[model samples]
Target: MAAHKIAHASYRGPSVVKEILYGISLGLLAGGLWKMHHWNNQRRTREFYDLLEKGEISVVVEEE
Candidate 1:
């Protein structure tokens, strides 16, 4: 039977500022995307509702 030896790993210093900056950047990107999606959805909803209100289009709802 052969025995295996495990090697020890070295520790590196941590950078708090770098981690914070990365988190902030990620948050900003996510927030911008969320805002863009929200704006687009709202615009579409408003347009559809406006069309409905103006009687420009008709919807047929079937009851089951």
Candidate 2:
């Protein structure tokens, strides 16, 4: 309708630069979090194996 055109005649959305920056920021945050999570899991696994080697932990297995 003509009313819809008149209402949005002067409306502007976000800039391209703003959109690019937002996307880059989001990507960096996600990548950093994923890296940290992977690093932590590796560290825990390493520590667990070291403890196991030192005989501080035990593993139980049963034969069927």
Candidate 3:
């Protein structure tokens, strides 16, 4: 039987820097998406209230 030799892998500094940059970019993308979602919700809420104030929509109130 013959024995085989295995080679070891080494880490490089540029790869580490690239990984850090990718993490930062992903974090920024998530934050941007969150901000956009919140902004859209606020805009929709404001429009709803405006329509209600203008009597464009009807609401039913009950007396207790």
**All candidates: CA RMSD in angstroms?**
6.6, 5.1, 3.8
lDDT against true structure, model 1: 0.94
Q: For model 2, name the residue pairs that clash.
A: none
List TM-score per model, in order: 0.71, 0.72, 0.67
In terms of TM-score, how similar is model 1 to the real structure?
A: 0.71
Q: Estimate the TM-score for candidate 3.
A: 0.67
Give the distance in Å from residue 46's predicted Cα in candidate 3 to where it truly belongs: 0.3
Candidate 2 wrong stretches, greater than 4 Å: 1-9, 61-64
lDDT of 2 by residue, 15-47 (tens): 999999999999999999999999999999999
Instruction: Estimate candidate 3's alpha-carbon lDDT, on a 0 to 1 scale.
Output: 0.91
Error of 2 at 54 (Å): 0.8
> TM-score of the candidate numbered 2?
0.72
For candidate 3, write residues 1-64 as lDDT tens digits.
7888878787644787888999999999999999999999999999999999998886877579
Best by lDDT: 1
Per-residue lDDT of 1-64 in model 1, one digit per residue for the tens? Answer: 8988888787878889999999999999999999999999999999999999998876977589
CA shift of 2, model 1, Å: 36
RMSD of 1: 6.6
